[model samples]
Target chain A: MSADSPAGTHPDPTLTSLDIGHPVYAALLDPDTAFWALVDKTRVADTLAGGPLRDAYRQHADACRRELHALRFELKPSGVYLNPTERCNLNCRYCYLPESQRRSGGHMSVDQLLASLSRLRDYFRSIMPEGGRPRAIFHGAEPLMNRDAVFAAIDAFAGDFIFGLQTNGTLLDDGAVSFLTARNVSIGLSLDGPSAGITDATRHTWSSRSVHNRVLAAMNRLRGYGSWSVITTCTTENLPYLTAMVELFHAREVPTCMLNAVRCTLAGARDVKPDDGAMSRAFFAALDRTHELYRDGGRKLVVANFANILIAILAPTARRLMCDISPCGAGRAFFALAADGNLYPCSEFIGLPRFKGGHLLADGGIEAALTSDAFRSVIGRNVDAFSPCDQCVIRHFCGSPCPAEAHEMNGGMTSTGVFCAFYREQVNYALRLIADGKADDYLWDGWDDGTETLIDLAH
Target chain B: MTQTVLTKPQTQRASSPSPAVAPAIAVRKTCNPDGVGLSHYVLMDKKVAR
Candidate 1:
């Protein structure tokens, strides 16, 4: 971050790339402790024997080494997840929330919710050096379940905080859409697949209604309106239909989509999780097909998971994803606020009691929570600290693995996550995409990921 | 400049423009903190090797 030369501002035009007739290969590298450099090596070696080109290459290489020698991980959290209620309407089999919290029917009153938000505001103001306006996400269980508190939070902080909502999409009515869109709140909807058979197999509603049909209706209402996206969780049953799902997203006019693997939890729905190779291959097909479909069109389509991975590999410092990054945003970049003013690393860490940082309403809460043993353990983790990861060729690209997921599946954060194989496949596929000259399709530069890291596609 | 020309078995996949021309190659040796070799690799062609 302290680099004297900013990205995309290299003075010499020839420094960015060699004009060799052959195709140039580029990758980020940390050469040695002696050189003390971090470089996006374009690999224009001195094969010219003796010439002006060879001298120019060496000059550019030396300049590259001197320009960027260090990287800073400044955690500027983009959003805070507020769970007004811990109760969801539908019982999705793959839902990772502990069954107890799901059934507890715990809801925070409007007063308590406001108090927690105010305290959080004070805490954030004290910490954020750059002065950022972080968004508030209505998340956990079903945020819409207690609509009153959700509205109150927005009303109170609309001037100070941006707003977004993550919902199952079945409950979106015209009134809700109108209100949310009016305020420019980003809406994130969830659907398992394109059709009912794929979705209803696991997402069971109490009223026995079809989940896919309800969500599709909402999508129809949401099209060409507010800032909205869809998240379709991929499980064992829906692996074969990955391409179809992305196509449906494009067809339905959903601007962005993310495919997530079913999380491995202590409760165990292991059978539903797809194998890494299967998921990766299926995901590749989806991405390739979507690229062709959306390329020439007036509209744009973004596959969120693919884009996040690209950002991680291509622009590591500018990564905005909560998961996947080493020492993932959990206790670092963001935190999840439970209904009763409790602070968890993230919504996914809600059910696990051991991972609770502290209650936000407590005195000296922000400092206490951040300094907790669990929080320290999570925040201090890096790829170089562990095995298999330390030796892994793509450790930097992979960010090691999701520690919370690893702990849930393997009983220790040090052990790799259950989805490590699938994740590895994703990293390798991203590299292949870069090699094939198709990486720009998913390299998103729009996110305010708390870094000035510019995406330099010059080479 | 020295241009080394060589030939090898062809793959079923599409070939580059000049397969007969021996590709420019570089062997990058990675050393761990202790200066021990981790692996042996000499990259020939980026497009094919990747």
Candidate 2:
């Protein structure tokens, strides 16, 4: 088809732009061999499955329908993350939950938490069977600040749901450790780095040394029960210590570390992010250091973002990597149960004026989110709307641009992020790392025939 | 027996069968077609035979 014809607007015509020839357009019909060469069939399938090709072609159309069905998880909102109190002990500059949203001293009572979670339990009951229960995350000013409310909700939903908590480690003491272990709760701590210089600058409590000392002590105490890992942010303050950070985690024997760039928010924390170039350099440096440590046969450290892209290259089926799809896990595949018993799409987009669908306590939550016009508008618009992303060759493998970042930076889901340069740099670095034989060991060398085709190409 | 109980709730939430609505903009990008090459992009909004 000619470029003038809109992609996915019309059905497959008698001939395509890929078409070799048609008498009416004899000259135009000649195949664009150069273009055809660039089209990787595997990449095309990945893109089409999640792209405009969902509507353009008909052969795998049924499969496309199933993909849509599975992707749109029309289940009850199983998890609730309450910002029980909005005032955090450690005011992380990059905190997405703005101070305006914090409840501060106004803690959510046990009854309030129970009301929200009971609605959650009922919703899950309506969606999932007994054994295939739901899960929830505890968040807020700090889940630790309102530890009793957190446990009460956990206890209320005990047999029917799993509980996980995200806390800035300042308050993670021995008692907190004991409580989590006794209840089999998973914990994710926000610890940016191994050194005081890096971690203290971003996550330190009032005492400057409080966060570092407490986090280390907490890590030691919780080393035995349930899972605990660090959630790191690459801020300007922490960028210089990338290697030190990874080495610290390696030394601590922490199994995993999720490395994320400092996301700018409306929370009035502009200074929190490092200069773009510096941040990108630091991230790449961290990736390089981790590879070095791996060669030395140290504890495994995973940079989650790269791990995801590597998985796409190396393994497609290892649980659809989260960020590969749209960001802001809205009505698509995820649901978040908020403290107010309101069911929002995902936690990140929780406070957005445009995002809240309806309350779970009122009726079934899935229908409200699924049928809402705003939510549908997002789901209906695929990778077709933006620039760079719309034309990206790696669009299929990269998934689409994160909708939240796109919304924040571009003013709409249909637009590309203004600062997409950062992501582009990361992708380029990853490609270089993989091609340089650094990521060779991670690539699968043993899949046969059918699997070999996928694995070999990734390597 | 428990599996049946679990999946039952899923069955009740039947598909609403809403009609699909097309997006306002093109979802996929294609290459230029002067019979010349695939290397060039026209950035045109419409599709046509090369």
Candidate 3:
């Protein structure tokens, strides 16, 4: 068999690039060794001629094919980010939602929300009979703005799904806390940092009131309620305070913190977006602080990004269903149900007409919406279809550069210019952490063996 | 469940299926104990010691 030949008739889309600096990486790059020995097994004619090594390689390839087939077909939608209302009380400068959409004051009617939930329940039942509970995350400009609607949907779907809320936290008064606590709903508070200087710089209400104190107070009020996490949008303004932010979350005993890079959207203000180099530096620094808090400070703070990357390295299937991965799991495994009852591939694609999957009508339901051209277009974008991604070493586990980010930055899904460097840097960092054996320090060790089973099925 | 077949793009490399198992290799070097590796985690493909 020739060295250049593929190992199978169809190239496995799940092939990931190893950390090049790692010894395993060098071995794979060499064509002669068993490290990349499977590469030559693609020569079907030669394999049929019968060698023990070739037979073993062929057996492994067949297993991979079967696993890939199941991943592409049988994976069900894990959760839905349901927008209860597009209207947010806080008018943050870096808000990604189109101003028009945010200003529309649209709220998902209780009937509409219930209908969507019913449809989702039916779909889940059809796909996974024993999958147990599905999840619905109530999100919006401020999901708390339509508190009644959020509660109604929660009460209606409480038995059928696990409930979660992502709120600006300014609206979480005693009443809101009691309501959330009663339902045992997991809540994610958006607080840029602990200090007023950091938080008030960007996050504020429409009336120009600084929401820093209110959000902090809310965090304090809801401390003991269900699971609580923090989501901070990393912008230029908050870059310097990243370590301080992690410290704040750790101090507050917040278990998880998600430092999401400010995505460059058409509606995003230019001044708010941090430069790529600066963002990368700040992110790494914050990650270091997080590790220190865990290792030295003995804090149980989990940085979601690093934790997710650890999961990706140890478990491939966990990465597969994530939205960042190639052939993004957006429209397929997960989607955003907008306030207007319109289905979007994800929250990022909510206002974009090109990505509108279908409407969750009262009578017609969500099945037809799943098959819409918009939905199909997103679900159809496999890693093999992407240009540089097909050749990318980290293609399998790198989340394949967000397609939404690609479209926003370069006007199409084919170009990954916006997040390519950022992803590469972060992925390499995660790989380094794993190589150094410090990954477990920052990660929650409670991950079930289900991920391992999934990886075995696929890779 | 109806399987949505993912169409392989024409630009994809004509190769064999990806190896299902991770390659076996020993750890050559560990990063600094102080976690200094975090700061230098940027892509270092060319500088890799063979």
RMSD of each: 10.7, 15.3, 11.5
* lDDT accuracy of residue A27 in candidate 2: 8
TM-score of predicted structure 2, chain A:
0.75
Off by over 4 Å in 2: A1-82, A103-105, A206-210, A224-226, A363-366, A377-381, A399-401, A429-459, B1-50
Interface RMSD of each: 17.2, 24.1, 18.1
- Per residue, candidate 2 scores C-alpha lDDT tens digits across A273-380 of 666688777877777777777778844566655655554333232322344533223455445555565555555555565767777656655577657765665554
TM-score ranking of the models: 3, 1, 2
Model 2 TM-score is 0.69
DockQ of 2: 0.01
Better structure of 1 and 2 per DockQ = 1
User: In candidate 1 chain A, what residue range of length 10 has the lowest lDDT sum?
Assistant: A31-40
Per residue, candidate 3 scores C-alpha lDDT tens digits across A152-176 of 8888878887777888888899998
Report the backbone clash tally of model 3: 9
